[model samples]
Each structure stands twice: as C-alpha cells, then as structure tokens.
Target: MNEKIPQQSLKGCKPEIHYPCVWQYKVIGMERQAIQAALSKKLGDAPYSLSESRTSKQGKYISLNLELTVHNEEQRLHLYSALTADPSIKLVL
Candidate 1:
C-alpha cells in the first residue's frame, strides 16, 4: 500500500521531523466496524480522525486514513506497530 512513497530518507539517513506533529496512516482491513474496534483498542481515548479511502471491487477489503498527533518518532512507530499487530488490520502504511 506504500505505492510511490515519497523519498524522505536517503540510505541510512533518517528524515528530520518536528515533534508533536499530525501523522497520517492508511489502515486496511476487512470490515469498517472491525477496523474501528481495532483502532479503539489501540488508541484508547486518544483523539484521531478516520475516513474511508476505498474498498476492493468485490467489497472484500477497505482502507481508512487515520490521522493523529504523534509526540515523537517513538510514539509514531509504536502506534504503527500496534495497528499492524491487530488481527483485524490487514496492513498499515
């Protein structure tokens, strides 16, 4: 799902990012409700925005764009890891 990702890093160099920034993550799953539940479990009471992206032609899968403010790279990666670890979530990008 990372099609044509932007070149943020060069080899081993990490991209510089300001702290407490809003990040966007594309979460793909089987069902809308299931995706919401999984996100709730992972995010707790944290505020976030979730919007439908698109569904497979057969309606087998759905992708949602999730936006939330991350305090640092660690928090951002932690959230990504949590989303990927959920059984209901198929992929995160």
Candidate 2:
C-alpha cells in the first residue's frame, strides 16, 4: 500500500515581496575565489555586490553575502538555482 503525503497550503504564509527589489543570498563555499568565479560565470555582467559574511570555525569554509536586484520572482529563483547548482557553492540561504 502506498501512503499519500498531505500538501501544505501557503495561502497566507508567504511574506509579500515587491519586484525589482534587492535580494540577499548567503552562499557558502570552500573557497572565496572559486565562489566568485562561479558567480561571475553564472551572473555575467549583471550588477551585484559580494562580501565576506563569515568563516567557519575550522576555517575550512567561507560564506559570502551576495546582494542583487531581481526583476521578479522568476529571476530571483533562477539565480538561486544557478548559485546552488554550482560545484563550488555548498549552500544557499
């Protein structure tokens, strides 16, 4: 027998986000240069700001805070997906 999982509704749970707004993404990676290279390859000449957020306790990883203006939800999501899919990027928040 197969069991069906209930789906949750987001009717009133999601926060309202205005389009063409600046969005911040925290990207974690093993190396800063690699992360920057990956971002550059993915984002091309798009305007963005990147800065060091924090370093891991052991100093094996680094997190970069990237801020960019997204035109819409699709653009935001697409960039998130691209960043997350990069080999150098370990996580995106």
Best-matching candidate per lDDT: 1
Residues 1-93, candidate 2, lDDT per residue (tens digit)?
896645565445777899989999999999999999999999999999999999999999999999999999999999999999999999999
What clash pairs does model 1 have?
none
- For model 1, residues 30-56, the per-residue Cα lDDT tens digits are 989999999999999999999999999
Q: Model 2: residues >4 Å from true position, as ranges?
A: 1-12
| Model 2 residue 90 lDDT score | 100
Local distance difference test values of all predictions, in order:
0.95, 0.94
Q: What is the RMSD, in Å, between candidate 2 and the native fold over all Cα?
A: 7.4
Off by over 4 Å in 1: 1-9
Instruction: Tell me each candidate's TM-score.
Output: 0.87, 0.86
